[model samples]
Target: MGEPNKIKLGISIGDINGIGCEVALKTFLDNRMLDFCTPIFYASNKTISEQKKRLGLEISFQGIPSAEKAHPGKINVCNVWKENPRIQFGEATEEGGKFAIKSLRAAVNALKKNEIDVLVTAPINKNNIQAEDFKFPGHTDFLAKELGGDSLMFMVSDDLRVGLLTDHVAVKNVANEITTKRVKDKVFTMMNSLKVDFGIRKPKIALLGINPHSGDNGTIGEEDEKIMKPAIASMFDDGHQVYGPYSADSFFGSGNHKNFDAVIAAYHDQGLIPFKTLAFGKGVNFTAGLSKVRTSPDHGTAYEIAGKGMADASSFTEAVFLALKVFKNREEYAELSKNPLKKHQLKKKTKAQ
Candidate 1:
């Protein structure tokens, strides 16, 4: 029952005991949000009610059996599970993890069936969300396996966009994971995402080095010169406007990130530390290089502020908006690519041949 041409957004409530429901409810409280998309939350009515009562919120949700029952201008809750798990705010319990996986799996299955146009997920407890059925590092890894694509963890905000070459890996293993093929794949993914998701025709990407001062010209480390520089050179030869192996320490400190359209960091903390530092409450984590659109807030489940009503919903709201924008942009770009002249008027030739 969504409005004509409106996208159907599927939301996966993460870590019931955390601030997932709080931020989600806050983000959807503004009635105007329904104008762009119909949100179908993958959670039970009991869960929503518990969150509302705990947060002292007044927003109401229309309980539905499935995504198809979602109505326009109304927040819909799809009961993925009937069992009402105990809500332990500011605590990570096994029950919380179990319900989080249930919600996420339900939403993901719905997405594969084309029941939702885009997905906006809340935060999850990575450690507790592990079980026999669900065993992955985080959302990106799970989505990569489910959706069958080389997923890139792309953090996006108004000021900067960053993609990770080695995501959710330990620092000791980062260098080994940054192979030539991985670098090329990540950069190519970033390039395509920039074009299709953000509507950038030709994006200039910067690469951050794993070592200090980009290995200080091989005096500090050889990876920057041997691995990173060669990979960048290959990309440039293939007509990509990519540069770097730039020093991570001075890159953000000197504001060199402003020079590029996007950045590719060698590891997670290398990129996220700066991204969160700058756009902590307003960044969106986009899963690039996937067939389906999926995004999440650039933060985790703030257990400490779960029931305190102090969790900021800015990142979650931005994630919703970014997902919608990316979905629309991809659709428009696909149509335009198919019919190059669809939006341009052909000039009449005036020649005496």
Candidate 2:
């Protein structure tokens, strides 16, 4: 009954037709993984077993009745559904969709009860999982609704941090959602998460323009000049180190983004296209503004090559590493906020004078 040495990780085994189960097992197979976390897949043992067989991977699976039974060096899975799911390598089915949803819900519930430190969700097929029985655009929207939190899908790689102003929205509708208030809120959320969650203080941020060449002073589009510019100006006055409505075309390569901590992308493709292009299979998708920390690989359920043993685990690893870092640093960040070093330096200087 002593305190468990392992941190319980609630992992949602995303779309079985894709690489979710594959990567989840592979990531857990690293024996050294026990040092950081003990994974509790919110999935049935059958689903994980089938995935391992299809991929021709040799790994052990242990069924645990509850989170308290979880142990390091073994996957402690809480079976979300009792029925055996019909899983095709690259095809979607009703049972598969339902199974994925069940697992996700279980993971979310575990997170709610404090049974897990953080939730590392694998990718899910949004279209397939949106049938009558299952619903959700993706994990971000689903978790946001479940946790009653405003979720911001932010993608991060080595040096790039991109937050979309509008995620999963139609291209035509993106412009309408880019209001000044919305922009300010997302910007502030990203800034706070950067400092508090990611240990980045004095976060320099860049705002992507809603137009070509940042509207060229109201020629291409007035949103940049009218909406984005004023929001950034207001934030600056409020003591934030933010800049731009920089032209999306050339801003990324100009080395300006490298100086800032994160960039707010106007829409899904606007930021993710460039981000994925540069950090594909390397970036981690994090849900900012959630009460609890959540992250996932910055890719989707690759149904085309599902069960082919071809899914890259780099993104998954990065996501796990990021979750651990964020969890551990939360306290450090709070301490830093309570006793800011910059304030102390200014105090010493004043005393000397």
Instruction: Name the top lDDT candidate.
Output: 1
lDDT at position 72, candidate 2: 68
Across 1-353, the per-residue lDDT of candidate 2 in tens digits comes to 21366667779988888888888788867867767888889887877777788789988867886676786667778877677787887887766677778888888988988888899998887776786644667888887887765578899988889998999899898889889999988988898899778766578999889888888999997899889999999999999998998889887777677878999989898898889888998899999988888999988888898888988888998899888888877866666568879556645775676
Residue pairs of candidate 2 with colliding backbone atoms: none
On TM-score, the leading prediction is: 1
What value does the lDDT take at residue 64 in candidate 2? 80
- The C-alpha lDDT values of all candidates are 0.91, 0.83
- Tell me the RMSD of model 2 versus the true structure: 3.3
Task: Tell me each candidate's TM-score.
Answer: 0.96, 0.93
For candidate 1, report its TM-score. 0.96
Q: Write the per-residue lDDT of candidate 1 for residues 1-353, one digit (tens) a residue.
A: 34755799999999998899889999988888988899999989998998899899999889999988788888999989898899999899999999999999999999999988899999999999999988898999999988987899999999899999998999999889888898999999999999889977678999999898889999997998899999999989988899998889989889999999999999999999999998899899999999999999988999878899999999999999999999999988888778857634311221211
